[model samples]
Target chain A: MSITEQRPVISKLEQQELRRLLAENKRIDGRNPLQYRNISVQLGYVEKAEGSALVELGNTKVLAAVKVGIAVPFADTPNEGILIVNAELVPLASPVFEPGPPSEESISLSRYVDRSIRESKSIDLSSLCIVPGRSVYSLYVDLYILDYDGNLIDASVIASVNALGITKMPKYVVEGQAIKKTDEYFKLDLKDHPVSLTYAFLDDKYVVDPCLSEEYASDFTVSMTVKADDRFCAIQKNGGGMISPRRVIELLERSLELGKELRTVAYRQLAGGNG
Target chain B: MLRSNEQQQRQRPIVVPGEYVGDSKFHIPGLNVYRLSDRMLATTVGLVRIDGKRVDVVALKSFYQPKVGDLVVGIVKEPGTAGWTVDINSPFLAFLPLSEYPEKRIRLSRDSIGRILEAGTVLVGLIKDASIFSSPVITLKGKGLGVVSNGFLLSITASKVPRLIGKKGSMLSTIEKGANVKLTVGQNGRLIVHSEDLNVVMKVKEVIGMIEKESHVYGLTERVEALLAGRRP
Candidate 1:
């Protein structure tokens, strides 16, 4: 019932050691500044969900499930389907998380995923229209944090993208004024793959995919979602900190390279079923 | 006193809650076991341990239940008017009253108390009082108990604390000697590793990680010894 977000108490000794390691372009986990932890993707993890995926970014685990339902289209975009993203930081995921209303951290995490998918045109929303302005398929992406080690943004993004990619919906035909369900089913047409990369700034240096302890010791984190074509679709910054214009440019360049690598890894796992 | 059955002790099997463990007439309920009529059932998911006539379930994972006289490492939380709230990695937050502090003739103001132990400060203390009615109280009046100025904190499952310490502190001594570092272990499953060398600290962390993962398996001590000797197990 505790809604307050409890930040772990980090000791001065840890902070100093982390900073000292960062000064030498090293991390406590022995990774380089730009190196990400091991990533594993499991598609269709939930049998009941229309589409589901569980992604593990190091120790951080996020499960994304897609549920399709019929709803009236929005007035502004009648021809497009609705994509609703909701993220829940389950209490069992970490000691800090509690059972209550969704925290701001969770709300913002969902919004970041929503923006990345919407802006990147990952799903062909227009194809989901049964009757313009009357009825359309609404895809709901629900993210559950199973384990929280750190860098949840990246893990959630990967899970969402993979879940949406495998989503399948029943076919519907226009019958005069009403929409009728057909026996045939069709898979969602995925247009692009978007992957997010998060970096935590420690002192003057930054480390990609910071672990839980590093996150507590860090100043802030910047997350960027890049499309398959090397174009940025979404950018978000969390925590209280400042970043220089030059450093922003450097992060963007790194995002472009790492984004492709991540997409490949995600897709290869899904296709090979090696996860 | 009842004697231990070596054959039964060697075949310790995992059991779920409500599963029948043994007959009540022959076995006594202990730890996470309950006597349901004439049968003994497990009250939690854990490995069964039969010591003499006592049938106890060693839970694989559980929250730390604070007990009196337990040494604990806690982090300073909010500073209240009467005392400071401390998080001891348990379900309940412990209280550290100003009176319990070793210092005497101290100012009673909140500002003065905050100066002594600010939020986020890590300290080692002993649980002086614990009950279901109120939060546990920890006192820093004992020897080797006070503010910890240096050391890296690492947390593991509280249930695995015994495995990490091993028999008669044998595993702990082995780790300290192998890694060349000092460790302050808390009953609440928090550890403070003190070493100037970063590599030594990392080595200790790796050993702890190994213990946490392989605690349920047999031959853990030998594997830990192999790891400490810088050989792959």
Candidate 2:
């Protein structure tokens, strides 16, 4: 599947025309801008993967998998187990993507997901290092962009984090230098959980969760990572037009307010409840 | 866009980069400028820059960047006469030349690259170039990035490979200590364990399978090792 094929091309002129409709409180989908497209999450889809999930926001779809293994430590930090994340915008997900390594866009999206979990202090990484300076368990989170509509980053992050949240680690022992596995297992200790929210500036207004067309014509985009305590762990912005100081303040307040609801939805899904 | 004096004053505290502001939970200190479409926003956390006017955004996790010289694992797909195409978990399929393996080199009048490297063959390779057109490119020119022989393949989470390796090979040593196995890990989520003892291979496979399912927990290594100890044959 080509990544480009998953997306519907809308030129700038076409976007402007759509925006005109949006300005009148009319969207192509005939809904308010703040209203999200349909959102759904499914877990345990990839039978081969230890843990897998699929998240769809409207037409965009992302598949996340969690793989486990033993690995040597990085040079800088030998004692701690590490977590790595990689994302692919498969040509099947959209036509713009070519079959190769990850694009910068895919990399950034994975990093964004990684940062929220890291900075929120969700999982204690230090505990994952089996033998400090000698051994550790490496967890790999691979995300495949199966389809592209809009709001992929948000969908990807939610699916990945929730998948990790629901994962269970096996019980093991290390006698001297030897490590062995047991039948027992336990779930991860997720403290002070975090989630990310995406906001788009459209028609000179900030909207939550823009679909493909609104995303196309939006003035700027902001992604905010909020921890359980509602602290901001990370934030990023993109656009040619600079946001005014007032707009920035307004956006932050709005994000903070919306994040609580998003977090609730994520937790319910992570807890195996439907969203 | 217009801002009142009070709004500008409130913004003054947010202009600095990496300065903690807002409430304890919402604070990121200073803000950095990032782009979306053609619009730019001074933000504190969870945003990204993209080409064109439309930008994508997400929360920031760790700051690990993709680089050359990294060891990766990929799957062989789309085969051609010149080379067999391998999907390295990136956006592109890495090419493995038949010339690289002088021992297994077979010549035929017909285009038969797929015969040598059929689809689903797991391989280990080095990231010779990560910024190839539309995706990263890998090469099998080195010692380890070639056909993995005499091993049972296991799939795990891709992110856990680094942690399993541990700082400077410590974690690998722990897993290999008693198992007596030659294990090869690929970044794209393929693991090959070679051992004469099927029991030991099965043990390692169980550990990896557990890790794949539970690597997101706080203490993954201990959990994996504990599981191994209980099931030792």
Candidate 3:
């Protein structure tokens, strides 16, 4: 068994070569730095999921599914219901992802999206609990990284937001100890919407939603989650290199710009779904 | 007096947060706001609140969250010294310890915990508890909860689970009868079917696959049965 695998170290000479490519505003794959890979979002793709969506960004593909179940609240937080988010970077999705417990990267990926939804108050968590201290409904959002090209965080976030938008919870009526469910359903209450935008700093110039090739050449990655109200909900800085404060500002502005477009695309695709 | 009060209450609508009181539930799919009292305007997200006169609703959003006591299907990933970790598709990776395993027939060996639970093992477990510290912990000692091995992992839309299960296990019974495959369904879309005949298993898996895909259509059970019957003998 191998002791922990180390990420590839970029030599000084290689860094110079990548920087030179970026200075020219040209990607090794012939894409302009700001250009995103081709993206496609399919809604209601998983028939088993209450609300499901598949998002393909370049070669990277992710599927998100939403399910609801009855549950008891935590002892401390009995009044509030629960929302569970699970992210799986399947070994099939990428070779680097081992078939074991969720890596820190995958956990962080789930958290970034989870925080955005929670802070945005996308769903009324309190309403989910049926009996304050006793039982309640819990919403589970699971994201499967089926194919990994690069920028899974962004793809997963997009798929989840759209899937949640398309989600509908079964209606329940509580009579004494028995809980009765009706044939009715309701959508989530996403007060302030959140969408994630990722940028890979290839060479030195930043590229919007990098593909696998660009990710290979890039040294730093940034994921920015923006709310519908134009507020920054979450920001994750990845990659091995250090990001200068000036570069952070630049990426933030670019993320906002790109986030608006991504949100519109997600809404349109989800709205057009036959739910 | 009681009859007048009942009539008045009927005239007023039932209100909830995030729901909009419109002419009907189909008016808006998301949250809707209605005036309850002069100072109390509640919000609703699902269904409309209308009796006959006043209506109260907020918005209607899909309700799919996780809570305690849910029978979840999860993937086994990290095997640690303390326990084997499972990803129940939650914000946190649910952990299952070897100690929780029931005392059974397998010979005892003081080996590594990770060795006993290699990665990729699907587990049907109960949520024992969750901690805000790091991740959620799960238990496998309960009835109908154990290690899932040697089966094809199938997924369906989370919303379709109720439909697949039907009211009081009706839907699953029909699928089992038609496909002749023993299946264990997890609420999180992870399903496993076991059968001795490889061909029959494959056929049954396909039928389940179709059911999962076409569940939104009316008469899904009939369609699944027809597909199963049409398979080669």
Of the candidates shown, which would achieve the greatest DockQ relative to the real structure? 1
- Model 1 misplacement above 4 A: A1-4, A270-275, B1-11, B108-111
Q: Mind giving the per-residue lDDT tens digits that candidate 2 earns over B42-121?
A: 45443333334333322232222335777766666666676666666544556666664434547756546777766656
Worst 10 residues of 2 chain B by lDDT: B56-65
Note the DockQ of each predicted structure: 0.52, 0.01, 0.01
TM-score of each: 0.92, 0.51, 0.51
Return the top candidate by lDDT.
Answer: 1
Ranking by lDDT: 1, 3, 2
Error of 1 at A257 (Å): 2.7
TM-score winner, 1 or 2: 1
lDDT of 1 by residue, B1-233 (tens): 23257534554588999999989999889999988899999999988888899988988888799999999999998788777999898989999998888888776643467788888888899999999999999999989999888777788888889888889999999998888788999999998988656678778888989987767666678778889899987
Per-residue lDDT for A1-275 in model 3, tens only?
33444442222223344455567775544567776777788988999888999999877999999998778898888978788889998987764678887777788889988987887677778867788888888889999999998888888878888888888888888899888889998876655557888888764577777776456557778888888777788888876888889988887788778777777766666554321
- lDDT score for residue A192 of model 3: 52
Off by over 4 Å in 3: A1-5, A8-18, A272-275, B1-233
Least accurate 10 contiguous residues by lDDT in model 3 chain A: A8-17
Which lDDT value does model 3 have at B166?
80
lDDT (0 to 1) per candidate: 0.87, 0.65, 0.69
Model 3, position B91, has a per-residue lDDT of 48
The sequence of per-residue lDDT tens digits that candidate 2 reaches over residues A1-275 is 33332222233333544556566765555557566667777877787766778888778899988876667778788877788888888888765677876666777788888887777777788878877777787878889989987777788877777667766777678897888877887776666557677877775766677776567667778888877676888788855577778977777777678777777765675663322
